[model samples]
Target: MADLLDQKVQAQSLVDVVAERLEAAIISGTLEPGSRLSEQALAASLGVSRGPLREAIRRLEGRKLLERTPNIGVRVAALSLRDLKEILEVREALEGMACALAAQNMSDEDIAALEGLIEAHGEQEAVREGKGYYQESKDFDFHFRIVTGAGNQRLEQMLLGDLYYLLRVYRYKSSTKPGRAKEALVEHQNIVAAIRNRDAGAAEGAMRVHLRNARRYVEEQLVEEGEAVVDPAPRKTGRVGSLR
Candidate 1:
């Protein structure tokens, strides 16, 4: 009985590991949205058996990161403009709460660490030489720190687990907008200052404003390009540890 239970546990662990690896690939844009997920090819590439690979794909489907059709197998989830805007709106509510809690609860050491993250963003070639943009990793780090600092288990899981991968997909898609990247650094600075002062209300307000501005910028860009923005499907609405 014990041996049988252990084997089952190990199998589940493999599935979880496989799911996480595939999730990271999808999030990082290595698996582009709408790309087909070939089961035999993926199983062979990852050196895993077909059983575990299929289980992992099912896990992603539960997370809404993969969609399966009767004829098409599975594909990475694609977001439309409305999808992006709705994501930002949900982020505003959740992250604003996180910023407020972080201001009140974070240790002095954590706050300093966040400031260091901002300084690193400022030193990037784009921000420094006025020729490039802040790297997405640095941008994600700043927000991840604050959310983790909030010290809420469920909140951390919701943001990091559910929304984060999708967030990365959209960020990469919209990163080409002129001038927004530089402006984002300045907004981040304001958010950091508010947290440094331990001003919960100000921290929350600043975080919301920054994200809302991002949403507005994307909407405007869509209009300019004449892309039809669809309405976001309502979904019921995270950060800790080294994301890298």
Candidate 2:
């Protein structure tokens, strides 16, 4: 019984490590979207057995990060321009509300930690060079912190669990636009300042503005690449107006 439990633990740990490694590669653009994945090659490259690698692939597949087709094997999932726009629209609404809730719910220590994250991002080499933003994963991102600070389990599952990696893929691409990293850093500061002041309306407004700008940037990039045409107009919505 003890050996069986140990074996189960070891197998799960191996799966976890393999999943994380593959996720990192996908997020880093090392594994391009829609590119076919060679399981044998992946297993060899990662120095893992086929069993664990296949389990990792299954987990990512369930996350919608990978796609499997009959007789065609597995490939990384690619988001079309329309798909990206739709996701961004939903994210703008959801994360804006999250920022508002975070402003009301987060303690002083949480707010301070959020500010420190921004500070650390500002000092990153890629950010300083105007090359890219600093978010490598949910753990290190400013928006992720605010969403977690909202203290809503359902919201956390939706944003952090469901949409996080998909958004990270496009967010990294959007942040590569010239001067976008610095602009986004300033936006992060504005968000943090509003949260620190406990101004829920202002926090929500700042978050919406930031995400809307990101949507515009992504649209522009897609247009430039001749991938898709996106409507550039911002949708009008009712204001939160002083949620103190």
Candidate 3:
């Protein structure tokens, strides 16, 4: 069991290749959510050793993109509204804190950079809303810069870890949702506006609103496409807690 778990991580090359391939598969829907992964079949297809494949699987499992069954092997984890809320709850708090810190610490250059990202996000949305390729890479760099420069190593690590699967899920689902590209543009503008104002309280509030809207939009898509089950929690506004 230990060896199987360490199989992919043993070599950087193998791990990188496997991780990239698996992520691509998930995002392309070539490896559909909830579809079982056959270790041997994938090993052969990728032309990699079983050890490396297992290691890649372990990494994906850690990211919550894949789930391990008891002696039955692995499958893509189903994204549900319940899980979305739970993940978003944490994401909101951490991101809010990050944005608050950014608001206090951001330099003039940082502010300009962020504005550029917001404008690029709008451009991406405009093209996509017209049924063109939705390019969100520019928007991604904005969040990356904020989290990395927030002077919180632990927070950076956590955010980086979630980004892998989060990007995959977003690229796949957002492409299918008609208005998402445009909505994302507005959401980003709101976040940028709060940060530029340097209002920590408002920054945090705006960040939460941005994330909650994204969560709601994504979950709505999942439900409509028969991909997830919406599970509502009693209003927790003004209330916060942890879910280990």
Candidate 4:
């Protein structure tokens, strides 16, 4: 009886577990934007009660990964190209700030770990195929660490909680463009070099330039495909901080 009670307390609840699985699917693009989330189907597929499934969805909704309509029920959030530009704008400032802080605050061990991560990325099959880039998630893992290393709790939560996931979906969609992967690798190296030297200004500048190039690539693709590019010019948001 004691063992049973202890196990009950120790095991993850169905809701939290389900929420995590659903969140992963969303992030991985397995559940594409605007995909309907049917409660009945999801509960049946996952072999869970509707009650727990609903709870799981509620959690995802809080994370901004799901949206519920009055009569239509829940679906994954879809971002417009305009929305993408706006998001990347926020990412430019926030991540640039993160890079700057990481240069100042990250420990020597952490910096070494980042170098090792970059080295590992260089060995990926994609890189060897002359693709020359880390997979989307692997690439994000590098940025995620830097964001966390910033040591700002609110900033960490804002980036990791919502914006990053949305960015991942878009980036995964765009990752297939020829030559982009190779270009991203070069930019990643530049950002890392600046951080290693503890040049906060250089680190932030490198990060902005990298993301700007990425945004430009997306814009060029959209234009080539005959889609309207909203505000193609990148705006200079005021400096995030005085980078030392």
Candidate 5:
């Protein structure tokens, strides 16, 4: 007899899809912090029953975005400098690991994609003058390229998952400063150069420096903005941890 626990994977519902969408909504700043999610309204808008919507909200709660209040249901979690630092630190480690592996395993096609992506998106003028959304997407592509290049599926998903949460904070506070975008592009170049030379150590070093710089910058911003509490709330749960 088949064990009940080992049953085949079931199909997910529209609720599950909307849940991920809502998760991204919160992660991308579409859903503002402290905003309350209305079950009736959301269900109506999404054209779904309350059951899936509630389940979805509960899932978001477990991820730390929607906190369950005693009588009041839930509100979107607020961002803080402390939370950003912790997230970025974890991101740094995973990204550094990706760079090291990419240096050794990146194929010619992967290298081409990286180079092309940088060439198209590396223009300081575009990042400095272009739409913030474009820059954000560009940044995402670069990071994704590295993760995919690394040939480590698990690690890749983990890194990108953390960045999704970070991106929400980024969209709100102008996380990457004016000159910082160009600097980051240069930093990406440095990492790529090391990879091209097949210097895993150098690639890892460059990647770490990049992530550390990002973490430090965001940390400073959080403090300067006065959102830096004495002790910030702990993360609910990582949005996504699996790389692949």
Candidate 6:
């Protein structure tokens, strides 16, 4: 019984390591969207057995980062422009609410730490040179801290789980748009300021505006690239819509 448990633990650990590496490659664009995966090649590249690689692939499929067809093998998931636009819509609402809660719930020290993170990002060479914003991890770190500070377990899970990983796949491309990095940094500063003041309303409003702008930027990109066709109907405004 003891030996069986040890073997199970070892297998799980190997799966985790393999999953993490695959996820990193996908998020970094090292594995392009819609690229086919060859199990034999991947197993050889990672120096892992087929069993563990298969398990890792299954996990990514559950996360919507990989897809399997009936006859065609597994491939990296490619999100449509409409899918990305819808995600931004959901994030604008949920993250705005999260910022409001963080303003009320986060400790002063936590807010200060967030400020320090933003300062560090400002000092990065890419940001200083106006070449790009924070790298994937750094950008996610800023949002992750705020989401965790909201003190809502379900909300944290929703934002920081699979959805977060999906967004990371495109976040690098989005941050590289002309002048967007600088604009995003200023928006982050505004959000921090509102949270520091413990003004929930202001924090929420600032977050909504920031995300709205980001959504618009993405829409423009999609239009320019002809990835999505815009509707001629007037846009509606009200409470944020549901992801469902």
TM-score, each model? 0.66, 0.81, 0.67, 0.70, 0.63, 0.74
Choose the strongest candidate by lDDT. 2
Off by over 4 Å in 4: 1-17, 44-47, 120-140, 152-154, 157-161, 218-244
- Expressed as tens digits, the lDDT of each residue in 75-151 for candidate 2 is 77767778788889999999999999999999999898888889999998988988878375665878888999999
| Comparison by lDDT, 2 against 3, better one | 2
- 9 Cα displacement, candidate 5 (Å): 31
TM-score, predicted candidate 2 vs. hidden true structure = 0.81
lDDT score for residue 161 of model 1: 78
Q: Name every residue pair that clashes in candidate 6.
A: none
Tens-digit lDDT track for model 6 on 114-211? 99998988987777776666444533478888999999998987888777876776665456578887888899999999999999999999989888
Model-by-model lDDT, in order?
0.70, 0.77, 0.65, 0.69, 0.65, 0.74
* Model 1 error, position 194 (Å): 0.9
Model 3 Cα lDDT, one tens digit per residue, 168-240:
5644465456766566667667777887888888888887887776677667777777766443222212111
Candidate 5 per-residue lDDT over residues 170-207, each given as its tens digit: 54244345555666777878988998899999999999
RMSD of 1: 9.7
Once fitted onto the true fold, the runs of candidate 1 whose alpha carbons sit more than 4 angstroms away are: 1-31, 37-63, 124-140, 221-244
lDDT of 5 at 118: 75
Off by over 4 Å in 2: 1-13, 226-244
Ranking by TM-score: 2, 6, 4, 3, 1, 5
- Residue 56 miss distance in model 1 (angstroms): 6.9
lDDT of 3 at 198: 82
**What shift in Å separates residue 237 of candidate 6 from its native position after superposition?**
38
Q: Cα RMSDs of all predictions? A: 9.7, 11.4, 9.7, 11.2, 10.1, 10.3
RMSD of 3: 9.7
The TM-score, computed over Cα atoms with residue i paired to residue i, of candidate 4 is: 0.70
